[model samples]
Target: MSSSVPPSIPRQPAAGSKKQSAETATGVTKRVAPGGKHALTETEKRGYALGVELGSDVARQQMEVDPKFLMQGMADGFSGATLLMTVEDINGILAEIQ
Candidate 1:
């Protein structure tokens, strides 16, 4: 069995690009250690819901709107959470059911 993945998962940029997409002090490494491995410690764990479809450009376009960003804001703050996990899990379960 195999797992499908996102078309592209953006790579965590090079060390020089530390501040890029990082929610932290401006250009400062948030880690206490020299390597700066992790930015922040998890304060909580949370659950999520997701919907995915491979058809229809219109549907995809609508999903890109920012109105939903607020609804999804810090709700995705949990340690191990992502929008695609739910999609893949549901697909795997359905495949097994069939």
Candidate 2:
């Protein structure tokens, strides 16, 4: 009896590498918008500023309360409203918070 096994094929270059090379050769690039990822409109900027200002006021209100309250408040605020925001944007904001 004769065995019947097909020859294996060699692997090609990675698709990602090919894409990167193509992009480089074509002078194609990507970058954050002037403001950042998910650039906020003027209205969004006003909302963010108001939210921060209100948070500051609330922080003072919690001077005698547990610190956890403030943390929970921040978590709630971030979770509740995040229009026109991306993970990168949120991370950058959190980094500034720290």
Candidate 3:
């Protein structure tokens, strides 16, 4: 299935590639607001910043968090796209983590 999420926020990196730092990975800071078109509004920028903070905290705690999968899940949730995993699968994973 196709995603509405922009390519800048990739779902995954190419195999064998080193993971980038959060700033470079997200490309949020480097993004230019182009004539207000495709530009994130103040609220959207704030939300993304907050999400990054929260995700960072989660990563610190979990240590094994895959950012690509996290981004894909968030994008799916926000875009109302069909999730990659079922509710039961999610619950099972959460149960395992717990």
Instruction: Return the top candidate by TM-score.
Output: 3
**Residue-by-residue lDDT tens digits, candidate 3, 6-78:** 4445345446545433353433333323243357889998897687676656755666876667778888878
Error of 3 at 71 (Å): 0.6
Tens-digit lDDT string for candidate 2 (29-49): 422123243678999988866
lDDT of 1 by residue, 6-98 (tens): 243434656665442332222322222334555533432112112212212224344443333433532453323465447667589559644
Winner on lDDT between 1 and 2 is: 2
Between prediction 1 and prediction 2, which has the larger TM-score? Answer: 2
Q: In model 1, which range of ten residues has the least summed lDDT? A: 45-54
lDDT of 1 at 3: 28
TM of each candidate vs. truth: 0.17, 0.28, 0.52
Model 1: CA > 4 A from native: 1-9, 15-34, 44-92, 95-98
* Count of steric clashes across candidates, in order: 0, 0, 0
TM-score of 2: 0.28
Ranking by lDDT: 3, 2, 1
Compared with the true structure, model 3 gives a TM-score of: 0.52
